[model samples]
Target: MEVKLHDIGEGMTEAEINCFLVKPGEAVKADDPLVEVQTDKMTAEIPAPRAGIIKEFTVQPGDTVSVGSTLLILEVGEQAGVPVKIEKNLPKPAVAELQAERLQSFAAVKRKRVLASPFTRKIARENGITIENVAGTGPAGRILDEDIYKFMAAAQQKPKLPAQPAPKEPAKRNDKVTSTIPLRGRRKQIAKKMVHSLNTIPHCTHFEEIDVTELITFRNELKDQNQTISATAFFLKALSICLKEFPVFNAELDEEKEAIHLLKDHHIGIAVDTEEGLIVPVIQNIEKKSIRDIHKEMKQLTDKALENMLTVKEITGGTFTISNVGPLGGSFGATPIIQHPQTALVSFHKTKKMPVVTEDDQIVIRSMMNISMSFDHRVADGATAVRFTNRFAELIQNPKMLVLEMV
Candidate 1:
């Protein structure tokens, strides 16, 4: 019996061959891991094609394969002469037509009436529009798109509406043909959650700065004891300590039925800057773990993040996320976007030396960092968010606070 591979996702057949765990002539049991495929959406490990001996193979490593595109021809052993049925989850005929229409053209006339979003259709109807202008506000200029007709109409109605900006589609750039990369993985989830958060929960950003000269000196002193400890690790330790006092920063916005619910767990997602992109892996049980434990976990998370084995679950779920780009480069000051549901995201920028007055009223150099706090105004008040940063600032400068709570 010949075995064929079918797609697991809707028309998403091709996948990057991550690795082949088995070689030809290898006897395998049912459900044994065989070909590892990295799809656009996910990585799947295709199992054995039945209780069979691999007769021949087709594709090799790093190959993109399509649905029904056989990876290998498996000759089923007589013991189980019946080949495993490959399941192809193609969309139904009508559904396929609808999807094709959606993918091909944004909106088209159907049954003497154009099938479009209510907004776009309304805009056309109101203006006595004879022609449907396919304006591609969407990526790739292909408008399977959303038409902001009300916004357009409202702006058009108001001549005083400050030089109604022309459509942004015709801008020319360097000889490069620009293309939009779809938001995938963490970026996709982040975009979705951000829209949901900003749309549902009101957001207000607060900015502040922290004088960390004392913290710098103390961190250097600790570096003498343990060279591996980073300023970022030290900051995480400090933030954890301060969070214990500021319980409101630990609360989450409950969108359903509208209420703010307090969660006791402080799972901190420390934003590690990997060569590929920024990833925030959670340091679980932050309140339970000591500073040393947090440091070790940060290192592990950083390493895994760079290596790309951290998994999807590792990249998500946190009451708050701390982005420590301070050590990498760029001087203090950045307003980071709040990482949704949590109501806050803290950005760490580079600390620069700036002149400041001391207790004795003399000018002195202090290491200053701009703490950009993006918080949901609905959940945390401007005063509360600023106060949280103020507390975080104090905790860092007071190095004693970091180690004091460690024991």
Candidate 2:
């Protein structure tokens, strides 16, 4: 039996092998964990298809394979036969021609007038155009390779009704190649998601500085009592309270249905920096948890993320996200991009001992910090986002309010 890499969920097309759980000549049972592979989104354990002996491994650790590519060969239900051989990569022309022939045969079976080779059909499918609408210019009015390319080029060209600016000439560069790295695994996934978020979401960032002298004092008191709490826990608690008051901050925009969904559960995603990349692990029902509880859970989540042991559920379903750059040190504030589907993100920077004016107008030193808020402008206007950040700042500035609520 052959075990081919299949869909690993989240529309992932490829995966890199992290490690093989079973060795060659080892026997494995049906539904048993076989290979552990890592995609850009998450790490997954691929299970064996049937009970069999591991005959050969076609891929190795750090090697990336396509979605339908063979991962390994297994001996099941009979003597282990020779491993199935994979064919060579075909030339572009031959591949397109063969694809077109297959499409032509399918069109004939369906009794349709569409006369496209596989490549042409693929182009139409990718561009979301109907093949039947494309007029053929080849023999017998059949669609040719050139015909598909011409149609695509024509469709992509902008109209000449309005005068357009002259395009800039292409820049010349050194032809010698330096290095090439395969965009695979987590890095590739991050690139795709970041690009999509930037293109689709209109982001508005608001930066504000708050005097957290009292907040710092409160946290130090807790530490004196042998109860450790993280600044992230404080931020999460403040944001959760703010969300309760402003439901719009906790809402998700449904562009397809032209609606906004206000989520009741306060699942706050804490962005943790890992060696591979940044991953956000959500803490569910944050509104119901105390600062201590939030701190403990955040520590566990961070450890799991660093070790790459976080589950899929742990990494998803964040109503809002908080990215704390304080630990990195020497940073004041940063405008972070909104994690897609989520309307807002809050970034925390390092605390510094800066001079401040006292309530009585006396100059004094205080533990002040800067926080950056980023929101999807489509869902929230500048005023709304400002109000939300102001409210969050108010909560942080008044540390006594949080202490009273916890009591």
Candidate 3:
């Protein structure tokens, strides 16, 4: 029987196949991971549909499949021949499930059978407490992640606080303290992806500096006329124009397969680092939009990025990406890792004052920003990347191009 891909998250219509863990005719366990599907927003590992031999696999790596799409067929193993229907991972229940669980527990178990997940139960047992004694604070008293944190914090006797120090002797030496930050959520994912990228992809870095004093002056002039426009909005208007002539910057190389994939649209992801680590929300069909539209959408994307309201579609599946760490308060160009598969990423520090001269070689102050870009050596050469970056720098350095775009 063919196991079809189902809607794993709300509003998720499709997913791009990222990797295949099991090959056809491979035997697998009940919950063994089969393939990984990366939607625009997140990556999920599909588990075995049943403990079976994969009879036929329908999807390949990089296929974009919508919900309810056929994914694979399997021939059930003998012992599990009854057909082990693998239930897809589900989000914790909503209001209706909460109410029903509450009703069932109130009348049926009467709080005797503490509703804790398997791992939580293990923690409870290790702490010498029975599941029934945990007293869950989760909906319908279903123990949750936070509940575990609270329990863990309470179980062990914490170290006592030290008294304020008396006058220390001059001989006292400074002592070093070591701290271990716990890995959780996106930070954890970022760590994993970074390691994967650094290990798997053959990467090369390039640096360039462009004087953009003219661009700044032009942006200010435009803003004076159109008070609501933003410099970034104007710059992107110019970027769209450059991309029309050069498409290599808009492509990706599949490292494992050694082939370049062509992206159909210009959806540029601007990497925004928050307390939630790096989230790259995309601006879709950037070339087709005007400066006003780009300005509005950028504002919206930034807000969504801040509030964590961005959907998977909003965050993933872009061919090109630009990351600005300037807003984070840095003003120096820095190296950024290439988001694997995507051939390149453009990054820069906040704009800063630097020394420059006009074509006449007049000594002067210029508005300049350092440009840092990372590229996949397998996909794009340095010359092509430099040309792409220069086009962006040219537009930024000459802001009048923006006015022409709107006209």
Candidate 4:
């Protein structure tokens, strides 16, 4: 039986074969993981359909195969028919050619026995470096991505032929060699999305500063009660409320239908920065969830994202998006790119203590946080964006208002 690659989820068209878990002639029971494949989003293992001995692999590690492409052949009991004996009838020259071909195939297989993931191999291929030539420093002599980079750097530093005596002229600034990063995998995907968003949507960003002194105090009180909730949870709840009031920001423009479709459900996506790239995992139906529940779920999703273990469902169907770069220590503001098709995205920056003047002309220190909200100008105007954020600020400044709005 031929084992073919199938669509795992999210209409995946192609995937790179990471590695084979079982070797040729190895016996595997039903549902045993046969090979690992890496999609743009995550790495998954293709399992065996039934108990069978692995006959041969049609594809190799790091080879990108489309859906329905043959991955391997399996030899099930009795159905695999007996091997034909055609070699004995062949002429002398034909037999010699067949033997030589077998030897070459064996050598090729032996050379590819190095331990490495598909991503590591991709980096090596992009840099024109051979995986076998690079030394592995990982567990059980696995070739890591860093090893491939180190090999390239060392190769570049090798001494070349002696240069001719230079004149009094100095070298040009552009003559220096610089390292290049390969645009592949997740980074490539992000670039494509960003370009599409910029080209298709006219984005307008509005910046605001909110006094979070009372909110910080409220959080400290919660910590004393042994119930801790993140500030982002409160922000999400407040945003959901504002989205209900200003439905345009939570809508999608259907150019074909010449109308804007306002969504009733609030599925918010939190942008997480990982070593691979920015991954957003959705928190569905935020309007119905409490701040504590949102905080718990947000932590779980962020952990999964950092580990690159999020499923397709966890990353799709986002009505709105939020990026909290506060923990990363950027105190100012940034014009965050809106997730395509979603009307708006808000990014919260670092908070710091600043002086504030009260209504009674009293000066005091307060915790102030900056936020940048970017919305599709075609869908909503700047005034509407400002009003939406103003309501959000009001809810956040008074944490007690969130309790009355909770489900």
Choose the strongest candidate by TM-score: 4
Query: Ten residues in a row with the worst lDDT in model 3?
Result: 157-166
- State, as a TM-score between 0 and 1, how close model 1 is to the true structure: 0.60
Candidate 1 residue lDDT tens string, 21-54: 5566554555655676655333456776565556
lDDT score for candidate 1 against the true structure: 0.62
Candidate 3 overall lDDT versus native: 0.66
lDDT of each: 0.62, 0.75, 0.66, 0.81
Poorly placed runs, candidate 2 (over 4 Å): 1-14, 18-25, 30-32, 55-70, 78-182, 403-407
Give the clashing pairs for model 2.
40-186, 99-118, 100-117, 100-118
Which residues of candidate 4, in runs, are more than 4 Å off?
14-26, 38-40, 50-172, 176-178
Error of 1 at 123 (Å): 49
Q: Give candidate 2's TM-score.
A: 0.70
TM-score order of candidates, top first: 4, 2, 1, 3
lDDT of 4: 0.81
Write candidate 3's Cα lDDT for 1-407 as tens digits.
Answer: 77777776544677766556556655565666666665534456666666666668798766778888878886673433322333356444654465454344324422233444433443454454544545578778887534655655677733222122245445535854343454533555577667877786677777878776776676677678876776667666776776676777678766578677767688888887654457788899998898789989999998767545566578777777788776665676777887765767777677778777768989788777777888877777889878887887777776776667556
Cα misplacement distance, residue 302 of candidate 1 (Å): 1.0
Q: Is candidate 1 or candidate 3 better by lDDT?
A: 3
Deviation in Å, model 1, residue 197 alpha carbon: 3.8
- Cα lDDT of model 2 by residue, 1-407, tens digit: 77998986645688888666667766556676677777766777778787666779999988988899888988664322212222369787876676565445333332233544433454555555566667799778977545666676788832122122345555559655444556655666778778888898998898888878878888899899998787778888988888988889898999999999999999998888765677788899999998889989999988778656677788777889888888777456877988888899998888888888878999988888888889988888888877888887888888769867555
